[model samples]
Target: MDKLLITRGVQRSPFWKFILWILPWAMLLAWGLYGAYLCLAEGLNQTNMDNRFAFGLWIYLDLTVIAFGAGAFFTGFLLYILKRHELKSVINSAVVLGLICYSGAIVVLMVDVGQPLRAWFTFWHPNVHSMLTEVTFCLTLYLTVLILEYAPIVMKNRQIRKVPSYLVFEFNLHKLMVVFAGVGAFLSFFHQGSLGGLYGVLRGRPFAFREDLGIWPSTFFLFVLSAMAAGPSFVLLTTWLVEKLSKKRLVKRETMSYLGKLSGVMLIIYILFKSVDTLIWINSTSPSSGFPAFEYYDRAAFGTWVLFAEVVLFGLLPALVLLRKKLRERMVWLIPSAVFVLAGVALNRFVLTIQTLALPTLVFDEFLSYMPSWQEVATFSMVIAYGVLLYSLSFRYLHLFPQERELTQPY
Candidate 1:
């Protein structure tokens, strides 16, 4: 029964093995759901987050996953809008990844908002001037665009394609893909920037604040560029992991190399701007906000070394590694570099979210160190389990990797 449902041209692990693997993940999902129920029933006191940290693990994870998910819209823009034919190989996988990232974020956000039922309030009673209002609008619209984009891919599954309507619907969807891709890219651009601006607008927290680049803060563009940099690298990393786990090649070396090159170039651009932005904040923005920037760093927690680690160790190193032909072509080297690129982005999100909140705003206030409760960790683990479960099922039943057939000729 399971074999019949699997994609026709590809081989999969035995049914029992697949079942065994998902059991733990299913348990994790249950745990996460229980944790969410607690948060909703017992209220915000269940978590460690207080007035100081209104946004906790849920928000941090949301920011990180969505940023990493940029590969979807960016890849779509390349394949459909910019006319980059090489990205066709990974477009399906990229879309699925984006769907997972965006949907999971929405779920976790429901927990973060305190009253899950009130989520509709953002839409019904809109605040036009708030940065969060802008984020809500773009995020919802872009997520819809992603669903429209990936729906046809699900219809492409062998069992689903048996229906004539599914086939015809999928075909028609392909024609308007350019429109969907354009909308998704435009929406993604604004929300990605607004997320950064969410903190930038916080004048009280000079550590998180940035100078306005015209109307938007410098952090706005930085967020967009950083997301684009991580997007392709995350795709490369996931493809590599799938190949390793399934023991079958899925994409060509040249295709992976192209992604690596693009990722590297974008990282370089982000780093250049980020470095300059950091210098400017240290020199001008912090001072203009009526604070001595170096005074914020007069403690052990957020030292000057943190900035160097963010820029040099993770940023410049991976950029160079991905750009080097000899380095990127080697699986041993390229895989770790891709991991570093993703880690760097994760670190950046952590700094912006946690560290920014941890710092004190007043002269007499003490710096803070946040530790998530068991509930928080469990909920976050649920996000990872959700990704594993969905990706497992999708890869088993659907044709996520279009080149899987050609690449695994021996299978």
Candidate 2:
């Protein structure tokens, strides 16, 4: 009975052991739900967010996961659209991770809005003029695409597939996957850019504002590039971690190398544009707006060194390492480099959201400082717990690793 649900030929932890491990994640999710309840029941006042800081940790986490979740569409683009058959082994895992990340972020957004029920207003009433309005539409639709992509994987379970109807459904879904992938990639590109555009179009806040290129800002293209760069590295790291956890080789090393190279190429392109954008903004945009580029650092926390670390330590370092065949091929080098890449993208989101709000627009208005209320921390932790639970369960029961059976069975 215990083994019935586990995929045939794949070994997993004892059922009770799995249950014990899941307990912690479940508890955390419950705690987070309570925090979300407080936010909804009491108000957004429950969070550290204020008029100046309209966004908080939840928005930051949303950006982080959404950026990382770019893995799903990008991988599908490589495998199905580009016909990179070598990626087949890792694409399922990418979809599962993407499903978790996208779904969890959507859930957080629901809670962050303070009235989960009113979320439909974006779709119903429709604010065609607002970037966030566009973002909401794209995210909601793309999330549906992710669900469609994920359904066939879930329906592949031993017991679920026993149903002839489910078997037929999943089979047909797989056939139409490329169409879905194309649509997903299309939606993802626009939404990811729009999310960045949300901040860039903030002409009222010079720190956050950017000069628009036609309709979109430089930040628009920068976001799309950065997301593509981070997505592949995240997929590589997740696949590697799954390998360590399962004690099995789930993907060919060449797949990892290929992903590293892909990521490296994208990162170099992103960093170059990012450098040019920063120079243009500091030289022209900031001064024209009467906010000197250097004046941003009047608040000690947003020091000059942050720009260097974001660009050089995290951005430049990872791109250089991943681009090198000799270095990225080694696990030791690949792991840290991938980690730095993730950190770099995450820091980019943080500065874009938090630092912009923290800076004082008026000389008399003090630079605002915020520490997240416990409710905010718990709410964010909830998403992390949800992701862990979903991924662990999917890995345990689904044939997410196509190479699992061959690798686990003796040659």
Give per-candidate clash totals. Answer: 0, 0
Q: Lowest-scoring 10 consecutive residues by lDDT in candidate 2?
A: 113-122
Candidate 1 C-alpha error for residue 281, in Å: 0.8
Per-model TM against the reference: 0.98, 0.98
Clash pairs (backbone) in predicted model 2: none
Tens digits of per-residue lDDT for model 2 on 1-411?
Answer: 768878898889898899998999999999999999999899988998887888889999999999999999999998999999988988898998888888889888988886777777778998898888888988999999999998999899988999999999999999999999999999999999999999899988899899998899988888999999999989999999878876788888888899888888999999999999999999999999999999997678989888988999999999999999999999898888988888999999999999999888887878888889999999999999999899999998888988778877758
- Candidate 1's error at 336, in angstroms? 1.3
Best by lDDT: 2
lDDT of 2: 0.90
C-alpha lDDT values of all predictions: 0.90, 0.90
- RMSD for all candidates, in order, please: 1.3, 1.1
lDDT, candidate 1, residue 406?
89
Candidate 1 versus the native: TM-score? 0.98
